[model samples]
Target: MICLYIGTNTGSCGLITAQKDPVPLKSVEVELEVRDHVATVVSTLNYENKEDKPLEAVFVLPLPGDAAVCHFSAQIGQTQIVAEVKEKQKAREEYDDALSSGQQVCLLTESDESPDIFSLCVGSLPPGESASIRLEYVTELAVQADDGLRFCLPAVLNPRYQPQGSAGAGFQVTSVPASLEPYSLSFSARVSSPRPVSKVESNCSLDPLQYLNTDQTQATVKLAAGHKFDRDVELLIYYKDAHQPTAVVEAGQASAEPGSLMGDPVVMVSLYPEFPQSVMSSTASCGEFVFLMDRSGSMGFRIKRRSLQTCIHSAKDTLLLLLKSLPMGCYFNIYSFGSRYEHIFPKSVEYSRQTMEEALKKVKKMKADLGETEILEPLKHIYSQPCILNQPRQLFVLTRGWVKNDKEVIDLVKKNSSSHRCFSFGTGENTSYIFINKISKEGGGHAQFITATDKIQPKVMQSLQFALQPSVIDISVTWDLPKEVSVTVLTPPITSILQGQRSLIYAQLTGQSSEAAEGCVTLKYSLAGHPSENQLHFSLRPAEDTGLTVHMLAARTLIRSLEMEARDNKGERDEEMKKVVEELSIQSGVSSAFTAFIAVSKSSGEAIQGPLIPPPSDFWHISAALLGQAQNYHDIHVCNFLITATESELSVKDPLLQLVSLLEASGCWLLKPALASVLGKTSKEVANLKPASASSEVWATILALIWLHGFKMDAKDEWELLAMKAASWLRAHNATCVTECVEAGNALLGCRVTKDALGL
Candidate 1:
């Protein structure tokens, strides 16, 4: 267990009692079972008290933001106690009473400031006693850019940087390095999908995949020998038919009363909307683009274990891609923040040669020198500016996600969501998923995470493409069911819909229907003034093997919406919403911010003596260098910076990015040495080869398009939208001699590119 100290005057001091021997936590064993997009995880944590007196252990850990924790229990010797969910205050009172009476008790509750953080307390643990804790949760895997399902098991919980005047103002964290941690983790996963399972990939070492069925739909994998719990464990699962829409209906709990959230069958529907090609071919020409970068000292850490690049450096590269991808005639600005924030321009400026170059120069010199993570202030500054007329506003936030005021940040974005859209990027293993996910959801935009093994350019460019697409409006979902049956939608209203993005909807089927009854759901929306709809039909029969996972997830969805509604209301309405939330949380046996899980062992009645003190772990900011480990960290930082600096000096060693950089704000490449060099030709040679009827700029633009198609065909996902923008600019100019330019360019670049391929 980890001990934390808060408030000022602490001075980075250790516990007066000295650190205990043989740290209470010993090892953890986890098993994961995944069916389709849903995953169920069971974890067992073993602890031993080696001290002379009674010990109370407190462990704080991070979970996925959208996970639903369903079960918690502890075993002490031969006795086992299962916890039950109750109102937070009532559970706390019972725990305190049990501890005072000398009974063994345990309490688990979600943090008020961050839903992803959970704190567990074990009281009155006898000396030399060992306890095994079992926790179970279910979560839906996130869809990645490549259509893979992403599941992350968080193992790192860095200290959150709190603002000076905020609640818990002086909170300081002392942490034991992963190498010094006294616990071991054993992990394994079992996966089954409706479609054939193609493969599974992870950043950590793993044994060979073992197939459980000849159809290749069931498989299992486990961590390799001598695995360390140093960073987050992430798995990306791929299926052959990934884009197919599907639905699962789960039967409710039998013991629960009818008409309750847990008693009714729940159905989860997954949809992937496809837009028309004509609408998708045109990119928006104008928008106010704002980029917010995190420059805190923590950003200096490696993006992932054994990676020779820091979070700040990767972010800089992504920013360069984003800046170069902006459409002509757009407005833009750049903001970087730490304890204090600074902007490249006092106000947003129109996109042009001068403005883009100016922003890139400042971004090139930026580093992670700032002391702390303070994001709230700069966000406010960005929101305060008056938006340009006829230009939509789009905000891009890049951070490592280590701020205390996450709830406040999310609320602020929710309040101002009507004015603009937000695109968020989280850049590390320990990135706060809740903060990153919530901020983007509230602002009606998309969220992406970049880990050690994940590439930053493709993901960021995908989100930029979403931003440049025309916004969808008038979204609605309609259901067609038997007359005797009805549906109660549990999920919140759909806000922003992007083409090829996944959306999940949960609903309760209350009435009875025939065994072979079929239901249909249609999603309707407008894109670029064109009406569109997608329909999915499914059988109403409950799935055979799904146990209350769907119902529990549905309950979680309603509970979250109610919690947000409570915060948005006042007086009687707020209290009323909270009451509903608490009742539903207890009824569904799911953990929430307003409720907690508590258990007491009635067999033990001996009150522990003396004041229970938890052993402290070494914790200090990485910038402080208070411990001998600083030298190792410093060495890693220097090595990463040197390698990244060399790569940057070579212009990313990526000709695609270099070609993108040379394109003008008007989406045309000028006939110059830089442009010719990207095409592997001399400036004089490119000029002499230009068609007689085509201008120099026209020839350069055609060559650029041909090169992108000829050499970078494998990376069409990253450059497709930008290429569309360039094509739109050419068509708008009514450029002549298109066939001549294509022929000359293809021959000069040694390619057979046609005019039709350039969208001319």
Candidate 2:
């Protein structure tokens, strides 16, 4: 789909396939500025035409799914042309007309099939001439499981797999390997937060963090000496108090007419709800848990360039932890998909000793042998199943998220959202964040990502806790503004509220108000029949030097809502909604699926007159092969190179996971050899250390709890609930020598945990 056209010296203009020999794009430079949870990114792309004649290059790149592209411009010599947003069809026509008349022009538009993919066309470049294109966009950073705000700049656009007979299936692209890529990248970031900045980490090499202020609230970091476009550029920013609620009121743009989305003031409110301890202490005992796993070839690919561990390996480990942590009396099932789908159970099965063992046995054998990524069919199957009475449905989807049918998949989830909650996990460096985020957002659940540098256990366990929490009801938001002022909410209604989860609300203030006035917004919800409220009172005066990031993000939110409505509406309504979306996109100068940014240069000296250049003889052959195979650039097989563990790796196990694996379905551990092995002792030694009056299962459970509290305290977020389950089981058994067992267990495991700490 991405091609470049270079005219011949003989004045022949023709469509030519992209050849790696002399690509026009030379280098890319990016600057990221983060304020609290929002980020603004500016990128400069340098291009040079080395051919004898004029060149036209088309490149398709990836962006964050939720990014609001706000600026586009091109600099040629002394003149700079700023692009304007227009209806997509009209913009394309204008770009073509300019090209025909030999005036240099450029066009940028979102992909029709996916929001994350964008195409840029630069035409009629003069021979040996250079151009610098500047692009700017704004996006909200995602909060991670470890309280780090995540910002990802996709450096690689992996080929999306289009299923047979799907839309855009024939649009094949030629991708040069990372090693052969003819471009360089440089990235820098500046971060500021209301709370003091704690630290910043990345998977790639980076310069040391430099604090800019006394309070450590502002800092800057950049990529180290040499950088390549081989993988995504990711940053994880930690703050001293990440869970605090905050609000930003940004003044509207001054140049635009009043009453428009861009011209009016906008406020972004961020809330991290904290549930009461009384409600949190009791976990749900009944639910239908369905886990959908992606087994496509891409799953065999490593999560990081330097790591030998593949995505499937980490995913399997996460699944093991999840299965072991489920509460009793719950119903569960597992589904794996590639080109085809398979389920371990014909239907949801109740949680019991036999069922748990059976599922774990089957899970250990799962492999990434499937052909391609096709998730829609399995989702449909899961939705069609009958919901159990009094037991809620909680779906967990794990995948690389590499598919072209993003809209279809998201629409399906939206339609069936009321029946269940969907928690999505994107597990590789090159995941389709748009796909992962949309499904979860629409299904009234949360989305999590697991990269090579991230620990998957904590993230998955957090989602499981969300699944077990009682559903929040009676959700409402109230705004208190000046009598002369009013508001219009741009974000969708709040439906799902979880403990320690950040929820964002964007609203537009249209009416005039005093500069010194203040406004208050309150969020109310009920958990387990208990009412709760959180309110934020912010100044009516707008914040300075915001660069309209909040307004653009708000406009993007409204446009996405309208676009989804257009898809769901009938012919006339759909047309009406499309018009509204296009008008708003153009008014706000934000790029959307229905609109594009176009700029034309009138200073090109002469018209380019040439016949079309013909592509090389091998172009057709290569295109055909890539199209037939779906061209999944990340689809690799896990072979000898990916397995770095020694043959005896199984013998030296993760003591925590080993101890967890020894727990029974009843949440008690038997005094077995595996338990002794996990405790770093022989079975005879452990048996001799047990209290004389304590039962075998009770002693084994106490030892496991002591070891977790003493050694694995760092991973408490992952094992805390399981330990609770074990404690509850021990209390129900009512074994004798309760204090003696605690003392003896601590002595045997070299732990100093008190009986009270275990909630005995």
Candidate 3:
């Protein structure tokens, strides 16, 4: 059974749950500085004490999976104190000791629950005083298919389901509705790259892009205020001459010695290795493909909308496309799960016309009706089935991507890696990225996230291409440097090397080397039976005044590698493990599970002991519930004398009214055939009306344009539906010639309906 303390105040949400704390966390602010391929974020959180006594405040939040927390500090009035990195236990003891002695202090530490989640505690704050905390971290961007580097600022942590008797799985938070969030976020990014920047894109609207230089290599953008924070803030940057592998050596901190983890020069090698044309051309496409689809309650909630198509519709369409494009000879099956699961075929079937048609028919009718997100049962069922002879097995998991038992599922996928290659596709905004990524990485497959802002088809097909392509094995990375200059590899061994994918290697360079010397790094892998290698040569000369980015990131990688080992060690806290983790954490000043950032505040007043403000969940509920119900704060009403409401008064030309009628009558976004009926026409006639353009006067033409903008941001009714009518409608009515009128209507109505938006 799962337990949650749902309260309305800043009580114990995590650590110090029953502490006599009085302060409640108030607001948070973040600033991002993007340079080249890495981003450094500084997050600030404010806590206020309104009670009559001293208090301790604790709040748990998530960091990006790849973020390396480097610096932490706290401020009250003009007194600003920086934190010292120390062993986790020692730091915790000191924090408690200081609080008990009536000293003001603050601490930040990562949770033992999950590596990406962390907790911040502000202890012993006097009445009416406010404390401000600032945390700084750096992370590298993930490159996308469009050659755009993507960055995401997280919003909420989707609660994961832990099985009975699972280890250390308490307090996993369930996701809250975005509208109920009682916080505000203001984000700004400054980007500087070597190559000329093309433009930046985001799901949330942004201020007009500003270029700092004539060459356009540096620019800045801010999230337009009043934008919703319900979803992760994602920024995609396009630059000229992208996809080229390169190396970077960052200089160390000035105060530290010249030959240490934090002070020594470090290098980051990006490898965009490409398989030989012969190898790619010789891909073994035959396989037994198994698709696991999530049919959970949260899956029913649509996170994105585009041209009347929902996340589920897009996911199903992607699956259908994959099914149709599979080679002539293959076996396939689909296992869908929620609280329960069922498979269409008792065993995998050959991918022929009859079977494919049967699967497609079933897929079209698939709904998100299962009660809860439980996928382990179906996964086990699929893994239990016997594999077919000669044909390799490929597992394609399609889901909302936010399942609870992710670690368990990931371990299972890893355990059954030999039986199949697992390709994971995440649809909808805020998909559980860590879950999808871990499964693919461990299962020797590729992962893709399809969001409302992305063009769903091409990326989905690209993942299919990877699935069809043969996997690369026996991967190794070798470094060539001077005799005295040794290297310490910070990341784990490269296991999965897919065609058109990228990888990175981080290392700390030790010993002395001439500035004229250079280093060469090469990656060797085997595709099918053929062996290949890719190499890069980088300079040894260190750049001047480089921040602690490279060192911090390298330490992060090393910490993760160590944590993985510790995890498999069954929570053993042996002396050797503790010593290594402590040394690394102290040396790099990077916070980890075994280390924390602690600061002390100098004060001259006596601390009051009043009624214990038990840190329960009650303090947090008020603001969330307040904002959630703020929806009806100022509802507009027309007096009877002013006007009377009637369905007959609704105009066909009213876009909103038309959309409502069409959606409600169909009960959902209807597909092409269903859309034909909605518009009182036969499928054949609807197909013939495809040439309607922006300027076309045809009835179908106007309907098609309206259809594209049907997925408005504030689409009144929460109901969503799917239809492909516009693509045919536009094509049949010569959309190119009708552009003028479409553009005019769009400008007048303030809506968007482009080719990409319609998936045409």
Candidate 1 colliding pairs: 7-170, 174-619, 175-618, 175-619
Tens digit per residue, CA lDDT, model 2, 1-760: 2253222232211223344354667789999999989999999999888776667776666799799999999986566889999988888888877877878888898876677777777777887889999999999999888889999888666546667787546443424334345678889999998889999999788999999999999999999987776777889999997999988899988887788788889999999889999999999989999999999877877777777667777677777778888888999999999989999999999988899899888877888878788899999999999999988999999998887677788889988988899999998787888889889988888899988634777898899999999888899999999998889999989988988989999999998999899999999999999999988899999888787889999999999888878877752337778899999999989988899999998865545455422222223233434343333433222222244432233313467767767778879889999889888889999999887788898998889888888888899998987998898888888877778999998888888899999879
In the range 57-173, model 3's lDDT, one tens digit per residue, is 656566876688889998876679899998877787877667667777777877555556676667777778888899999988876655678888777655554444555332235
Tens-digit lDDT track of model 1 for 1-760: 2244321233232211225343578899999999999999999999887777666766666787788999999998777999999988888888877877888899888877667777778887787889999999999888877778888888755567778898665553434334456789999999999888999999899999999999999999999999888778899999998989898988778898767778878899999999999998767879999999999877877777676677887788788889888987899999999989999999999999889998998998899877688999999999999989989999999998888888788889988998999999998767877788888888989889898534666788889988998888999999999998789999999998987888899999887888899999999999999999999999999999888999888988888888888877751338777889899999999888789999999976567665543211111221133332322222222322223433454335667878877877677888989888888899898988898888777888889999998888888887776787778778988887888888888888899877888788
lDDT, candidate 2, equals 0.81
TM-score of each: 0.90, 0.93, 0.77
To one decimal, what is the Cα RMSD in angstroms of model 1 from the true structure? 4.3
**Number of the candidate with higher TM-score, 1 or 3:** 1
Task: Give me the runs in candidate 2 sitting further than 4 Å from their true place.
Answer: 1-22, 170-177, 571-573, 605-653
Per-candidate clashes, comma-separated: 4, 8, 30
